[model samples]
Every structure is written in structure tokens, then in C-alpha cells.
Target: MSLPKELEVLQNFFVKQPNPLLGVETIQVLLFREILDFTVLRTEDTRELNTVITPLSTENDENVQRVAFLGSKQKAVESRQMERLLRTAANEADYPIEECYLKDYLCLECPRCALYGGTNASASKTTNANIKHRVAYSTAFSLAAFEQIQQTTTFNGISDLTVQTGQTLNERISVKPATIFPSIVTLHSVTWKELILMMKIILSSHKYGAESRIGGDVRNTVVGITGGWEEFITPLEFTMELNSEKEKSLSAENVTKILNKYKLLLANQKKSVILSPEQVDDMLKFISGFEIDKKFLTKAYEDVRAYRDVQENSKAKKK
Candidate 1:
């Protein structure tokens, strides 16, 4: 998907929060399938688990017959060590557990292990590990929790998020969108720019769902594009509120209020007029793009311009 112009502003203009909103959902699924299928490599130190420790018999005679103790040696089981290492990697990577619906699934550590006596015991255990690995290896899901990971990693700058899944390695990465944003409103279609902007807002937030986590002092953030793509890191809670006609009207009003608040915040900061006049114009464009009222736009423009004049005058006096 093509990045939005506003998002490009954020990516190109902002030094601190530069990053594109890449397809997270596609990547999540790819990672999930690959991890579950045991085709994807998660860590160099780990290998696919073929079996687990099973108890044969407690009696010495029975144990001798069933367990067949090979002569004890100092050799480490490469597979076991790999499994252990993968666990450690997942923990360290802060792999996201949400996309795989990890929350709904039975916890691996729980008393009732689903894989313990299940017919496909080995398959079940591998499935669980794969889910964990998906969250761990996923560049998008990993960054959903803390904003810094998204900003610092090269996840989005890479390519179309595709992954292969099967009982083997030669599979193709699944073709799908990998995003954490919730679908509140159903539009016929969305542009790449729109997707990226929505993703930035979603990624900057805590999680994706009806209950949005896009929190913080909204005053400190601005929605725009960077690196010629749509992206945002703001405090506005973007969720599909009541999708009725009345709710739509209320949402429009809320947008007005938010713009006014943002304007006031800009005024208070007395920061450099970093945003160009064209960028300010784009804000108006976005408002109109959504069919929002022009009143809020006019008011915000005046306030921002006044701030710019103040900045310019201050600079002249100092000169």
C-alpha cells in the first residue's frame, strides 16, 4: 500500500519519530503459520522439537525395558537445547501474544496441558511455540506494545509481508495484510495512505480493538505523513465509535474540538514553527477530505499563523 502524504511528513520531517506503518497483519499471519508449521527459523540456537520427555515406567525393571538407557555421555541433545533457546528468545523479544489469539488459547504453563495427552502431542506443542515465535519474530506486533521498537526497527522498510507455513521450509509466505488496527467503520475501500496513517495511530497506541490504547496527552502529537507516507504518533483515540448517523455527526464535532485543542497546545508550546504552511494547508485538506466542517479548520489556521508570526517577530528582534 502507498503511504499517505501526511504520514510522509511525519517520516520525512520528524527526526525523532520517523517510521512507516507497514503491513503488520500480513506479517503476523506469515510468522504465525511459519512458526506453527515449524518451517521458519526463530533463533540460531534452537531447532524444531521432535519429541518431549515422556515417562515410561517408575519400576526399575519396567524402566530398563521401556526407557532403554543408552550409555550416559556428556553430549547435549541439540534439539532440546534449541527448544530451550527458542523459549528464551521469545521471552527476550517481548513477542506479542495477541495476534495469534494467544490470550484465548490455553496457556502452555497451565496445569491442564492441551498437548500433553492430545493425539497430536508433538504437533500441539509445536503449535504453541509457533504462536509465541510469531509474536516474537513479528516486527509489527512487537512494536505495538512500546512505540520505540516500531520507530527503531527496519520492519516496514523491507517488503510485502509474506510468510510460508507448512510441515516444511519451501512454502510461500501467506499473502495478507498484517495490521493491528480495529475496524470501526467499514469503507468500501481504503488507500495505502489511509492505511498507513491509521496504522501509525494504531501502532503508537497500545493495542488494536474496540477499546483503543492510543493514549497520552493529545496536545503533544500531530497526525501527518512522513517519508512520503501516511503515519501518525498522537494521543487521539481512533476507534469506530457508534457507527450510526448520530454517532457520525458527533464524531465530526469531536474532530473540531480536537483540532481546536491541538491548536491551543501548539500555541502554548511556543516551539519553532516547524510545520510548513503547506503542511498546515494539508491539515485543512484532511478535514475536508473527511467532510469535516471548515470552521475548525479556519480557527486552527488563524491560531497557527498567529504563532508563526510571533516566532518570526521574535527572531527579527533578536537579529
Candidate 2:
């Protein structure tokens, strides 16, 4: 997924890679999600529950265990999950990747390595180097409070988003269907390709939270995107800004309106540019039509092989 030369102006939004990430340049994005079905988003069992206490209103005083989508949950969706999907797609297209998909293997050369930071999966600090994750995600909070918007049930018989009562004995807690979670994702020093791909991943991905293999169904929307030297806002702050409203849904218009307030800070107008609804839609249309072809996959594999060779050669020298 690449942009045209005319769109090179958008490159101003991303920091030039191959350089240190000073955090000054960033692309702040707002991602809104709706719970389509049963989704498990919990840390640990709290009396067989997975929730945390947090403010739930514009007042910012109330706190409760509304279904919270942790940052780690979506990070995995974008990193490990997206990487696995890419590999599968490549192999299906007959452009098989030599790099293993095992998480522990940490080929260290895949597209996500530098984009999603990780510990030296080799578990050897001296031999392997860690990559910095350029993208950052924030935990999303449900608009509806826990008591009103969550359901718990015990059942069996499930395959690909269906629940059967007699299949087996399983019990879990999930938020009510159609619940909304307003989120913010920040990208630091990402290239044009990385930024667009992130949008595709966010808007296209269907599953979220724990136990996603069976029953974590979600739909995500890219509300708005801002490019600037500073991160515009957080999920919590975005929530607060819209808390006064009765409806908690995402639309390109509302998103632009809220973010437009922060377009200029103090007397500086160059700090950021909040994309208009039309611009956002244009980008969305482009991504929907964009296809990752054999050429892209071939170059991706070549880069992976080259990076792995370099890392191996470096390790050998250190030995």
C-alpha cells in the first residue's frame, strides 16, 4: 500500500525514518469501535469478572468496571495478529515468506519489528537487539457503564461467532452488543506506508480482546487523523470532550469538529492539521481499494531476509 507522488505533501506528517525518534513529530489518530457481539476484555478474573474502575461521565468523578479494551489488546491486533495475516496472505498468493511466524522466533526483520517494539525475543540481550515500536495505542473505555451494558452467560457450542448451548460447558462475561469505545492511537515517526497500513489494519480488522479465536467480535472505525509535532489527545480526553453529548457514536463530521478546536494552540497554527471529513473519506476509499500485490510481498520478503542476514552476521562477529 503506497501513496502517489502528489500525496508526498502528506509525508510532512511522518518523521523521516532511519533516524532517531525524538517524539516531536507524530500522527495522532482517533479510532472508534463498536462491540458487535460477545467480546472478552479483561485483565484477570475478579470474582469471574474482567473489569476495572474508571470515570464514566463528563463529570469525570464516577468510576466503575466498564469493559475496558486495554492498549495491549489492540497492540497485539496490529502487530502480531497483522503480521500473521500478512504472512498468510503472502503465502496464499504464492509469495511464501521464509521467515518463521513463531512469536518467540522474533525474526527481527518483519514489517512490525521496528513499528512495534519488543524485547529481544531471542531472550538474549547481549546477542539480539530490541526494536522500538513507533506506534502507541491507548485503552478504550465503553460509553455505557458496566451495570447497564454488560451480560454474563454460561454456554457451549461455538464456532466462528456463534454460541450453542449444548456444545460444551463454558462460561464468560462480555459487554452488551452495540457498545461503543472511543479510542486514540498515536504513531511516532511512521512512514506513509506504515501510517496507511495502520489505518487499514484498524478499520479492517474484526476481532479484538482475549479469546478472540472463538468469540471476540468488534468493528472499528477511523474517526479522524491529525498530523503534527505533538500528540493531539488521548482516548480518555476524547471521551471527555464528547461526554456532554447523548449519543456516543463515531462519524467523520463529529470527529473533525471536536479535533478542530485543538487545531491551533495559543498562537501557533503550524502545530497540526486535522484532516477534514472529505480528506479522511478519500484516504479511506483509497485504502479499501488498495491491494498488496506480489511485488510488494516480494520486496517485503527480500527486506526480511536482508535484515535477518545482517543480524545473524552481527551476532556471529560478537561471538
lDDT of 2 by residue, 79-163 (tens): 7665775787787788755464436656555666656655665633234566666788888777667787777787766666654
Can you tell me which runs of candidate 1 are displaced by over 4 Å?
Answer: 1-13, 16-249, 266-319
Q: Could you give candidate 1's per-residue lDDT for residues 1-319 as a string of tens digits?
A: 2234653543332222111122222100010110111011122223221111222211111111111111111011211222233343344654322111122333333111211111223323333221111111111111022221111111222334554332432222111122121112111112322232233232222211111132111110223221211111121122122112233332334433333434444423332123343564465456335421233223322332343355456557788
Alpha-carbon local distance difference test for all models: 0.24, 0.68
Native-vs-model 1 lDDT? 0.24
Residue 212 displacement (Å), model 2: 2.6
